[model samples]
Target: MKRKIGWVLAAALLVLLAAGGCAPKTPTAKKKPTPVKTEQKAETVPTYRVVADNNLDKFKQTHGQYRTINYDPQDDLVSLLPESLAKLKKYPQTTTVRAYVTDWQQASVQMGSKPMTVLTVQVQKVLTGKKQLAKQEIRLILPGGFQPYGQYDKGSIYHDNTIPDDEPVLTQNNQIPIPTIGSTIVLPMRKAAQYPAKEYLAWLKAAKLTTAYVPADAHSMIWRCNPQTKKLTTNNPLREKELTKWAGQGNQTWATQYKRLTAELEKQL
Candidate 1:
């Protein structure tokens, strides 16, 4: 009786295995992939301050403003005009243009690490020389604008100055004010190729420009003008001296030179 019972139980187990009742079941739900997170960086703000070259060191031990760092000598107009005209023949603008500052950038000249101001000007009128640049936008580079601030002692700020030197501020030499945007002005311009390896000729090659312009001289090249009134003035003291020199030759006063210059430029136009 016991042997028959065991054989019957074994048969039942075999039948259940053949029917696939013990097989593993497939998963009911699929897993979802995790999403990735990306990080964003913030833009850095630049700090800048304008200071005269003489009064550059104004912390702890104060630097006097009396000394001259880059003083321009009085120019003789009689000699300057002929030489300027001859040089203009080699460069662009044997002519002058009345333009407004559309935009500007401060950069360092690679050769000497000197500061320069690159201006984007829109010509409003042709004052003298030629009319080709009239109503055209152009670029001009000039010396002495802004330079990277040098390292100075920060802990020695006991005297009077409050700012720290190592704070990464751009120290601009404001002896000649940077031409303000939208301000009308007159420029006597020339190609930068004349100053190969010295000025902005090689530095601006990355811009892919055919060429760029520069002033004949740093002092008298820019003249601030009222767009509506057409009154002209310059920030450079040497420019006044040159006009005074011209006035002296004509038996007139320094103030009269402004009108005379305007008349001369208009006659050329």
Candidate 2:
């Protein structure tokens, strides 16, 4: 037993010695120098271009971003309008109904809330024009009513010589109620895609319109219907261009000015 115990002790000692020799060498116990981390610079953002090739999604994505939007000169409408007006102008030949209504007592009745409400309308010309050059029918869309500007009307100012500007500007105070005249009303020629000529012809008669002035270059005709003395005019930009767009270089301007000139021409309706 004593011999065995002595042998076991010797084996343990040899193992310890072997382990010590195998241990990783401590080189003067030198501390590793702390790693110096180079600071990384942030990536630079891109600069904006006027023709940013911005589409609907991009415009929405970058609307409130820090960078300002660069607009093209031909896109003058965007810069001139307030956010709401700009939104409204996104549609062509669209008129908004802006008016109000009210009561003597309770501001809002169960049937309604405020004196009025502004509506986003869809106006389209649903008819084919002279030789299909223009669309003649106009659709007045009033989803609800006039959007209220304020509580008390400040006063009415003249908009044009056609109507007195002194009309009382409505306020929230007055019990008077106003109706949205026309906020978004349009005449789109694309309607023929969905409805055929005979269909629109039926609508034209129902709406009391005519095909009187069928210009050769026009998609639709401008007619004078004596029943309501309603003069229906076809809204055609291409026809307007053929008639009004001057010589070279002016063609581009015509497409831009087409809306305004078309509106004026509609008065001849």
Candidate 3:
């Protein structure tokens, strides 16, 4: 009975082992790794534009006063008043003027406690306030701390001051030079009605006008005269040719009459 019981127990154990071996095995699935996320930097764009009419009032307010040099044939440096200028209703008290930059001086101004740059330009032109200027040179003051954008020589032409939309604006470096030099710029000028003429003269004298210096080859549209009207006009083709020739030959007398007018104005200034 013991032997039979042992055989039955062994048979039962074998049966259990067979059943365990025949059972289906389950497979485990592999997990995928999460991808890393990355961030990108944003690009910077310039928004500043050259000062224009839209902001001119604001600029004047912040800058203190808006002043411009008047091109007068009588008191300023001018030899012969252009017919166009002479014919204008406001000839001597013009709102606009063209000039040639003969020299530049950087000055320091004490505004409150901060020292700032005041650009003084020695210009030669034919018009002023009193009489025709004869080869005269005078110092004109730009009140703000104006710095030029590019290099300029003695003979650079300053057309008029007008900031166009296409004009380049200040960069991140804040190194933009004045656009009036080296080109014909149409700058809008404002009369200082509140300031007396004597006061204006005093301010100019304080600028310490540089020594008289004129380039032999310097020629500007200020000397051109319209043949048809026989008046001072910038549109004279013949005058342009003559100016070009004089400039090529380094002739300082090409605008002799006009330059002489400038001399008288210099004395008055």
TM-score of each: 0.52, 0.17, 0.25
Q: Number of backbone collisions per candidate, in order?
A: 1, 39, 47
lDDT of 2: 0.31
Question: In terms of lDDT, which candidate is strongest?
Answer: 1
lDDT per residue (tens digit) for residues 109-202 in model 1: 4335455567777777776566777877777765544332333222434422444333334333333556655567776666676666633455
> What is the per-residue lDDT of model 3 for residues 1-269, given as tens digits with 9 covering 90 to 100?
99999999999999999999999988788888888887686764212112223244454455443332222112222323433323332543442333433333334433222122322222223343423332333333332233222211113365334533233222111111222222221111223332346754454345443222221111232222222433443323445566567768878564554444433323322
lDDT of each: 0.55, 0.31, 0.35
- Give the higher-lDDT candidate: 1 or 3: 1
Q: Which is superior by lDDT, 1 or 2?
A: 1
Scanning candidate 2 in windows of ten residues, the lowest lDDT window is 98-107
Give candidate 3's error at residue 112 in angstroms. 5.5
Worst 10-residue lDDT window, candidate 1: 46-55
For 1-269, candidate 2 gives per-residue lDDT tens digits of: 99999999999999999999999987797799999999898875322111122322353453332211111113112122112323433544333221111111111211133232222122222222223232222222111122222212235252234323333222221111212222122232222123347754554344333321111111322221222332333333334445454534566554344444344434433
- Tell me the RMSD of model 3 versus the true structure: 20.5
Global lDDT of model 3: 0.35
The true-versus-predicted C-alpha distance at residue 67 of model 2, in Å, is: 42
